[model samples]
Target: MKARILFVCLGNICRSPMAEAVMRHQVEQAGLNDRIEIDSAGTGDWHLGHPPHEGTRKLLDEHQISYQGMKARLVAESDFETFDYIVCMDTKNLRDVRELLKNAGTLESRAKVFTFMELLPDKGIADVPDPYYDGNFPFVYELVNSGCRELLKRVQADLKLA
Candidate 1:
């Protein structure tokens, strides 16, 4: 089975979608597109059906990373069963996702939910800041890129794709 990954944040328009695009790019580059699946969602429903934030779009365009056909979506309880990894952009997102799973009575899911920063503990950063407000897409892109690279390695090892 493909190793499914879900990137999450407060609003799908920013960090999560950026991470999704970056991870997708890396996966395709590694030739693991066939072995892995990637997607993104938000803990909040505010941006449902909306495309990524303008900053995200512009930065992605600058990097030549395609965010094609990507839309903001809310995290669903079923995601617990569907994705092998549910990566959050920050601590609050992580808490919200776990709380959602708990409230849904999905105490035990195959998905391992965690903050994106957990993949790069030495970075001394706990959150992938929201560029929607600060307009720091470039910095967020750097964090997302680094995290996605590490995440790909973890997924490869976990799924035995490496």
Candidate 2:
């Protein structure tokens, strides 16, 4: 079965979407695209239906990473049941997701929700900050790039990928 991953952020226009695209790229390059699914969402509905932020699009463009077909959407309760991992961009997002799960009464779901930075080697780095406000897309991109790489490595080992 394909392992599903869902990236979550406050608006889904910056951090989460960037992580989704970067992680997808890493999975595809590793030839594990068929074994893994990538997706993203937001905790709030403010940006629902909106495309990723211009900053995110531009940064991904520079890296030749495609964020096409990505649109902001609020996280549904089903996400906790559907995705293998529901990774958040920051502490607020993580707390929001946990609350959502609690509200859904499925807090014991199979999906694991945590910060995207949790996969990073440095335990001190706790978040992939939202770049929508300060336009710090480059910094977010660098962090997501490494985080996704490490996430891929973890998935590779977990799935016994060749």
Candidate 3:
């Protein structure tokens, strides 16, 4: 059975989408794409149906990461039940996701939720800083790339992928 991962954040504009795309790429490169399903969403519905933030799209373009055909979606209540792991961008997102899952009854035992940063303590970066409101796209790009790389390592280790 494939392990499903859902990335979450306040808005689906910046951090979450970036992490989603990068992690998807890493999983594909590692040949785990067939056994792992990756997707992303937001705690709120603010950007639902929208493409990722322009800066985010641009960064992906620069990296030659194919993020086309992706649309932002609100994290549904069923997501907690559907996903094997729910990864949030930061502590605030983690708290909100926890609250959401707690209220969703069946999700109470269906998912393991965590902040993406928690998987990579050795990097010393606690979170992927949101750069949507700010003009610094490069910083957000680098943060997501770093986090995704570390996350790929952890996921591979967890799955014991050779």
Candidate 4:
């Protein structure tokens, strides 16, 4: 089975989608596109069906990463069963995801949920700040890029991929 991964954030138009694109790029580069699946969603439905924020699109374009066909969507109960890893952007997102899972009685899901920063504990950062509010798309891209690189390493090890 393919190793399925999901990136989550509050709006899905900024951080999570950015992570999604970056992770997808790395996965393709590693030739693991056929072995793994990647997607992203938001904890809220405010931006449902909307494309990623302009900052996210601009930065991704600058990096030559493709965020094509990625529309904002809310996290669904089915995601717990579909994804092997659900990575959140911050503590609040993590909490919301866990609460949703608990409320839906799917807390026993096989998926391992965690914050993106958990993959790099040495970074000393707990959250990937929202570029939508701060307009610091460049900094956010750097964080997402670094986190996605580390995440790919973890996924490869977990899946025993070379």
Ranking by lDDT: 1, 4, 2, 3
Candidate 4's C-alpha runs over 4 A off are none
What are the per-residue Cα lDDT tens digits for candidate 2 across 61-140? 99899988999999999998899888899888999999999999866878877788888747577777677777788988
Task: Give the clash total for candidate 2.
Answer: 0
What TM-score, to 2 decimals, does candidate 2 have? 0.95
Q: How large an RMSD does model 4 have? A: 0.8
Looking at candidate 3, what is the lDDT of residue 9? 86
Model 3 ranges with Cα > 4 A deviation: 123-125
Compared with the true structure, what per-residue lDDT tens digits does model 3 show for residues 45-99?
A: 8888899899989888989887877889988897877888888988989888888
CA-lDDT, candidates in order: 0.93, 0.87, 0.82, 0.93
Cα misplacement distance, residue 151 of candidate 4 (Å): 0.8
**Span of 10 residues, lowest total lDDT, candidate 4:** 103-112
The TM-score measured for candidate 4 stands at 0.97
Off by over 4 Å in 1: none
Q: What's the C-alpha lDDT at position 113 in model 3? A: 86
Off by over 4 Å in 2: 121-123
The digit string of per-residue lDDT tens for model 1 on 129-152 reads 888888899999999999999999
